[model samples]
Target chain A: MSTWTSDAAALRSTWFLRGVRAAFSLPGLILVSSFIGFAALAKDAGVTMAQAAFMTGTVWALPSMVVLVGAIGSGAALPAAMFAVTLSAIRLMPMVMALAPEMRTGKTRQCVLYLLAHFVAVTSWVLAMERLKRVPPPMRTTYYAGLGGTLVTTNVIVVTVVYAVADALPSAVSAALLMLTPMYFLTSLWGSARERAGHVAMVLGLVLGPVFHIVLPQIDLLVAGLIGGTVAYGLQLWRRKVRAA
Target chain B: MFILVAGFAATDIWRFLGVYLGGKLSEDSDLLVLVRTMATALVAAVIGNLIVFPGGALAHTSLDLRIAAAALGFVGYLVSGKRMVVGIATAESLLLAGLYLNF
Candidate 1:
């Protein structure tokens, strides 16, 4: 009983420290940068600053928010807008996989994970994976919780600022801000490409994207990612087999 | 915009769902591996689409211009030992320069 109680306390404390670390990490910076784009989109679309702020607090996903604002601004149908957002968000399923492992212990901790998953994002997931791999399993959950909480706070603050100033920015600045969204994703991929397969996947994605677009515009990204990622994965497996033989 | 709203709702619903599901899923499940590959592929696809068949502001530039900028960014990333900011800045700078040349 004593051990159980101390273990719980230790878990809580470690998690708190992880949250503090999150407030000061690269993921925090990425979130802030991307929110700038979101604010610019909200401002340009004539969405009320308050509404925009509320969206960020709740949605917390930039691509979907961008699609939402863009659709509304362009007078696209609601279903179309929602579909776009959903399609962009399909990425979240994998994100859940990458992050769920960090919070695992037993059945009771599963409930806590469900509560914490709302905070998952590219930045938070990356940071959590990096930190959790080294820490003891008992402390990993607390670290993830702390990191996620810090990210939420940072996002809230950034969204507020961007929404407030949305109307005041020049066209060029607004455009640049919008570009930052994809730019961050692109750059982050560069950082993630440590392995040869990752490098090949990115290059193939980059090269094949435009070519496929010209031939079949509708299914371009899908084709490129499928073809590129498959090739990369297959090549890696093949090479491994050869190495073994 | 309704679509956008729905999209937002759909995505967030998943996010909220994540909070509940995070602890329940096994890390080493075959389902998880399939999901990871699919996600990676999707992102790769999106990036490919953006570069090859860009819409909005990116559409304004020529295909060559976009490709060049992306290449420059890739080279910068490699030369800088894989610094993300460097790769992004290189691409942005190249794109801006292409704009200046075209205009």
Candidate 2:
């Protein structure tokens, strides 16, 4: 029993530390810079540093926080702001769904999964999906907890500090910093894709996103994802059938 | 306060639902594949929108420059054995150089 307890303790710390180490990587830097930009934006919108940090921690998703800040900045009503934030956040559902199965094991408790689910935003999702395949299933949850927990805590501190000290960042500098996120996402997705259909879906979404934005502004992302993903999956199915036949 | 309540609920409901639903399905199920694809596409769309029609500081850069940086970054990423840091550095460096040089 003593040996078993020590073994479990060792496993938990090792996996958790691995996750924490991963948080200092490129994705982590990108997450930090993005929030620095966010802090400036929040300050400009007259959001208090406390509020900005709160939103960073609670809302977690950058895009949703942006919408919330924009709504408050514009003096929009509460329900309107809530609706906009909710709509912007709908994308997280599929991301969480994709990640949950990767982290769950038969012995994993439902409540533990729920706690980890709070960290399933874009960067964490991408990082976890990329790395989780190498992790033992039982340790994946612990790994994600460390990664996500470190990211959120670090960003909260960064936002609060940057908010208090920095003048507005130079447009060029801030723009370049902001560009890191999409650039990271694009490269990571391209490199880490498990199948050709993933690539096809990415390309289709890339093309369709802008088109839908022009044609249908509000639900552009939803429409693009549904159509692009379906079409790409259909193509994959067809290819499989052809190979079999 | 309202931001807290609305934002948390609005964003987190999906996460909770995902966990609940994902718990029910096996990892390699066809339905998970669909969900993964949709998620990938959604993120791709977000990247596309951010690049094509950016807000705040990113909007200050020319569209051509943004596209060029992203394209080159992708190439750099591919050529460098998919090192994410290399891609991001190459892109950020190109973007800053372009901005400074008025390219």
Best by TM-score: 2
- Each model's TM-score, in the order given? 0.70, 0.76
lDDT for each residue of candidate 1 in A191-225, tens digit (9 for 90 to 100)? 64435666677667666766766786555445666
Residues A33-120, model 2: lDDT tens digits: 7787678767767899989999988989886786677668767778777775675576576677789888878898999999999988
Supply the TM-score for candidate 1.
0.70
DockQ of 1: 0.35
Q: State model 1's lDDT.
A: 0.65
Could you tell me which 10 consecutive residues in candidate 2 chain A have the lowest summed lDDT? Answer: A1-10
Q: Please give the lDDT score at residue A153 for candidate 1.
A: 75
Q: Which stretches of candidate 2 lie over 4 Å from their true place?
A: A1-22, A37-51, A62-109, A121-144, A163-166, B1-7, B21-23
